[model samples]
Target: MFLERYHSIQDNKVLISARQGSLFAKEVAGDFNPIHNPDERRFCVPGDLLFALLVAHFGLSRKMTFHFRSLLGDSVPLTFREDDDGMIRVYDDRDKVYIEVEREGESTRDQSIIEHLIRSYVAESGKNFPHTLKPLMESQGVMFNPDRPMIMYQSMNLSLTTLDAPEPELELGQATLVPDGKRGNVTLDYRLMSRGKEAGLVSKKLVVSGLRDYDPNTMDAVVEQFYRLKEKAWD
Candidate 1:
């Protein structure tokens, strides 16, 4: 699987190195969030990495929900456990849970379906910054620090009416960012369509910490620089 390079599995435990996580963010997800930079002092693993791994291991379900509890760093050993109820949990050495995945409906082991869903969902989710997020923050009158943007994935859930259709696609429906002091919670509602028909709805939550007052000029510069880096990467 394409996800093998992002993590290592040994003795039923998995670990994602900083370099691997950084590559997955930039190369796979096309996300350039500073928090995923390997050299950053507070670098954290991308939640999308965890999401990919979960599906790769257990296969894709018609309806799924993931709850993130804590951020995982490089060299942290994570163990996966699933109960009889079909709930999967990823925990660290101290028994601290990092992520929980609940799946319902039928699960498919078809690699093609799994990879297609992974690629499609990650691509849509990665467009958060500088695209969907910029307008959302503007409406809320708050934004993250331009120097050190700290946006983190909080949770995500999707309910699909049918997974039988092919060519699944995601489209942003609505979004809202609610600020609480220097922190804010972003709720993005999206719709999943298959062959031009709506098949499901998804809700993604993100937490932006270390926020500051929104400055139009500063935000404009940030958005410009973001695309510059993206362009430079592909060039």
Candidate 2:
């Protein structure tokens, strides 16, 4: 799932945060583990770290592997590793399901459910979306910029100018955001989305403007909100 990690372990400590996945982990399976919760012991250290690492490695292999209270009462331990060709392979303790990362250079013409959903969210959002076709949409640290959250927005195309407004507000270091896929050519949305549904769409308006004519106060508020709710799409 999104909360898995890939460790290049030598002794015990993580050699590097090689793969940091920050996405939603599913408990779709029957036997979801208690440790997956935020309050579980060392939850922050192990759970988040592991998930981030898995995402960095797995990309989008399975549907975030959710196993909540298996058909039988059993705890399923998560497993991860790389194959000879450097593919990510994962298995639940029960071994009922398995996910193997596609070869690195393969095209995503055939993507998983989650990958499809993510693509859908970006595609419907409007014109000039990334479609993420070129050099790959993902990267380290640069995936987000508090000042310009939409830089990585999987737009369908790119434009000389794109803008959004209504100046939504969010807590410091964050903001509420939604995918707004229905809104043609959107950089961001003021509304928040229901994470329960992986990909929600919205229709709204965006405007292009000059930096000098822009108000820092409004931008600051919207930027903060963007940071807070970005993960949810509307945050």
Candidate 3:
């Protein structure tokens, strides 16, 4: 019953900017401060804010495939904890989220499990961190008849750094990323594929949008909005 699968931050590129606490937490504290903005009384949490920032920093992917320029340069170890229970487990001492790709032929579509685990992980995480699938679900919701998503078999480099590449004749959706990192040429497109049939259902260049802070208060509201779109975003 291989339905669908996903990959999070799987590289060793996560910058460890804090000891007792992560720098990400510190950033969240400032932005998600409840008292900071009286008009914007909502305020986010360190964990939730960190996740959103990762989405922004990493550049959203179509079926979970991130752009090359958005990740750590050269070689980075793709790592994450196994199973949904321990997947998004954000430890109080560590402000980080683990990422991983399932083993071959694995049924990655487990929305109930995903929702449950995320909910539990953030249950006591404060108003800022709403542990639910509302946000992600709003976009893609759930891949019910989840088909096999594209598997990136290989990625390479080319001459000319700063310059960009011509748009591919074939693609499922729009793909883009922050252009401030690398330089020289840009004739390369991070190619991708599906591990199963019906590969065209997904885009070769997936664009995963980062978490958005709202003018309205609370992460719960964001979660509710996520599920509405997640089911169709992939389509």
Candidate 4:
């Protein structure tokens, strides 16, 4: 229900306007990536928004994996399809796929449970930049290009031991970055906590391109600029 304003369905096709996507990125997920800015030339909907929409529409499965195939631009008319085997695909009218999902095991359509998980996951995800990735990059002696930071959501997997928790929260666990030359793969592991007990786990994979030798001074400026943008947006 919270996602209603972020997207629209007409003629069985979904359309997400740039403003809608931007609001969801900043207001909901707390992600201030420039690419999600409405006026940016490279504006695109946040991948986490799409992930949240899937769970909201199809319910939360015990095991689910989302593989992002392409960047979804604003106002794209997309369609969703689910196969008998529990594979879901989100694609544009051109038939170009943006995300593919595979789900298994039990599921729940409980709105409270879904909303809680969505909020908790995105809140933790919004901290990936300075909180998680910065230290990981520093330890690995690498950092994304300062001028043109290119970090993309590649895929994410979710596994739940049960679907009984109505207000489960996500806590960040171990995070790792594996670098291969100019490209780096980032994996963020998270735990689902219900009433102080572990309920399940989730992992998000990201691809960072144009990585170069880490420079503390350069990175510091980048981080500062990021916070500045966030402040300006809220102002």
Q: Which candidate should be chosen as best, given lDDT against the real structure? A: 4
Q: By TM-score, who's the top model here?
A: 4
Give the TM-score ranking, best first.
4, 1, 2, 3
Q: What lDDT tens digits, residue by residue, belong to model 4 across residues 1-235?
A: 8999899988889899999999998988888888889998989899989999989999999999999999999899988889676689998878899999999899999998898899888878788888899999999999998978878999999999999875678888888999999999999999899889999999999999999999999999999988999999899
As a TM-score, model 4 comes out at 0.96
Instruction: Candidate 4: give the clashing pairs.
Output: none
Q: Per-prediction TM-score, please?
A: 0.94, 0.21, 0.18, 0.96
How many collisions between residues are there in candidate 1? Answer: 0
Q: Which segments of candidate 1 are over 4 A away from where they belong?
A: 84-86
lDDT of each: 0.87, 0.29, 0.25, 0.91
Report the candidate with higher TM-score, 2 versus 3. Answer: 2
Off by over 4 Å in 3: 1-12, 19-23, 29-46, 61-97, 100-235
Model 2 ranges off by over 4 Å:
1-53, 57-75, 105-235
lDDT of 1 by residue, 16-133 (tens): 9999998898888888887787898899999999999998888888889999999899879998889677789998889999999988897788887788788889988789998898
Q: Could you tell me the lDDT of residue 86 within candidate 4?
A: 64
Candidates 1 and 3: which is better by lDDT? 1
